[model samples]
Target: MRINQFISHNTSHSRREADELIKQGLVKINAKIAQFSDRVKQEDRVFIKDKRIHKKTQFSVIVYHKQKGELVSHKDDRGRKTIYENLPKKFSSWLSIGRLDFASEGLILLTDSALIASALMKSDLEREYYLKIKGHINKEVVEAMENGLEIKNEKKGAHSKSKISSMMIAPFLEYEIFGSSGGYTKLRVVINEGQNRELRRFFGHFDLKIMDLKRVAFGIVELDMLRAGKYRYLEKTEYEKLRDFLRINAIKF
Candidate 1:
């Protein structure tokens, strides 16, 4: 594998972070400063900051059913409850794959293997969510959403010229209206890309307020009957299924 990939797979750093470390001359291969294009052999020795790197063997993957009002992060300045607090003490070293916002609740994956987390996040794996929205559910609204909508980029600075962009919603891939009742609509949404609050922003264009959002599935893993504020170690079959889904041959860590 490439040096960056090797570093990222063997260490806690992500691929991007590994590139930064190489650029800073902190990484070495077989006692020589490594280049970005360098490849690793099974027998090759890798070091970071002059310390020999040893691959971690015991890796844990957890599927957490996050509850609303809990932060995905480990700490909060305001002393709000966080998902980490709900986890066992042994999982303090694990990292969440992505984040669920303070108000959002659902399946969030946590893993001790950074390589697995990074690979899954970078892949085109689908994340399924069940959204409860306050709106008059109609064919028009569903069609509009399926056809895509222009939503302002929340991250763009005030002075940015192009603030609006089309949020692509593939009818067969990203959206499907499952049920609706009494001005409350439930929809199943599948998104491959991890856009920042894309669902909330998408509905905002139609003035449809999301009353509740729950992620029911991610990639090959389903929330199933996993209770809120609870977590369970991923089964061996589940872990292998995820690896197969990502088309990853092996996990070094």
Candidate 2:
């Protein structure tokens, strides 16, 4: 195993943070400052900034109905408000799995298990979003989006190649399938990639404005009977489904 993985499995810090510590030379393996790629055996001694590692709490999961205008991160440099401010005090040490932009609202999953969050954030895991867009949508556009829409002028992260674009099509994308008399239409978008503002940008490519957007489903978890701005614990069956799916797909830390 890698030194960062050992720190993550035994310390309170999340895996992402563990990698940062290793990169910053704050972590030591057998009295030597650790590098991210350093290997460790079961008998190796570990320390984080001179403190010995200890076992962290078991993984816990929660489903939160994020309100609009709340940033998904813990701290906003611009002083914009965040969803963490509204979270219960007892729910510390949990990391958000993926994210919903400040203008979008819907089901956001939080977990103490770094592995689960990382697994769910993988591009292979399917996520469903409910979108309400302005103006009437055309069947050709819907079909195009369902096939794959190329979005220009978007930031591509380090993990992605340059000129990255999201490529998830609506399963039932017929134009006659959706309608709203008030000039707004609703549709469900199922995608595997969770790039920043991807779904909204997809519609924007067709000159469609997203008035409201929310994620209603991820993996086996759905927003059934759940009200807005509330939270609930996931059931055992849902957890099992997520675990089985991750295992079958070879997603592991």
Candidate 3:
């Protein structure tokens, strides 16, 4: 890994902070000052201010059942509840695979390794959800789900501060409608990629409001019997599957 990444992952410093420290001549590799372009192997010894840095090689993953109303962040300036606040203190430094918006909740994966998180987040893994929305899911929505949709300069469902003006929503991997009742419709949907406020934007274009959204599965990891606000370590089988996936995808560390 690059020296900055090494410091950031093994220490509390961010990459930018690591860069600043390197510039200050505090970071060392094998008793020599590390350059900005330096890379280290497993045998290399890295230190910051003479304190040895230990990079954990053993992989660890946690599966958390994210409850609604909790932000998927470390600390929110708005003082809203954050996932880290509820997670075990040991996992405070772990990285979430992706994000579940504050209003949406369900399965979440956290890992201690940034490389693993980055690989899974960018992969075209399936994300499945059950959702309820205002009004019936009409033919147009079904067609769009199957054939994909294109929006230009329409930011209806996106976050207010989002700078995205144009987005191309890919076709859904699968979708199941359970019919509408009492001004609401329930459906199960699947998509491979996580776009910015994707489903919300898609339905918002049709003037429909999503009343509830919950993810049930991500890739091979399922929410299963885990209750809201509960969490568990990934099963051995689950970890093996994840390892096989990364290996098959030829993801390099």
Q: Which predicted model would earn the best TM-score? A: 3
Candidate 3 structure quality by residue, lDDT tens digits, 110-199: 987877888889999999999999999878988999999998999888888999978899999999999889999999999999887898
Quantify all predictions' global Cα lDDT against the true fold. 0.78, 0.74, 0.89
In TM-score terms, candidate 3 sits at: 0.92
Please provide TM-scores, in order, for all candidate models, with all chains considered together.
0.75, 0.79, 0.92
How many clashes does each candidate structure show, in the order listed?
A: 0, 1, 0
Model 2, global lDDT: 0.74
Best by lDDT: 3
Q: What tens-digit string does per-residue lDDT give for candidate 1 at 1-253?
A: 7888777656667677899999999999998999999998889999999999886655668899999999988789989999889888877656788877888999999987767777777767788898899986666667765675554444221123435454554343677777778978888888776666677766766677788989998888899999998898888998778756655645444
Question: What value does the lDDT take at residue 151 in candidate 3?
Answer: 88
Clashing pairs in 2: 146-169
Global CA lDDT computed for model 3: 0.89
* Candidate 3: residue 111 Cα off by (Å): 0.7
Give the range where candidate 2 is weakest over 10 consecutive residues by summed lDDT: 168-177
Which ranges of candidate 2 are over 4 A from the true structure? 14-26, 31-33, 41-45, 49-58, 153-176, 251-253
Per-residue CA lDDT of model 2 for 1-253, tens digit only, reads 6776666656667668899888788888879998878887757778888987754545678999888999889888889988778888766567899988888888899987666677778745677777788877787676776577665555432124335554443343322335676889887767777766676666667777888888888778887778877889989998777667877878663
Estimate the TM-score for candidate 1. 0.75
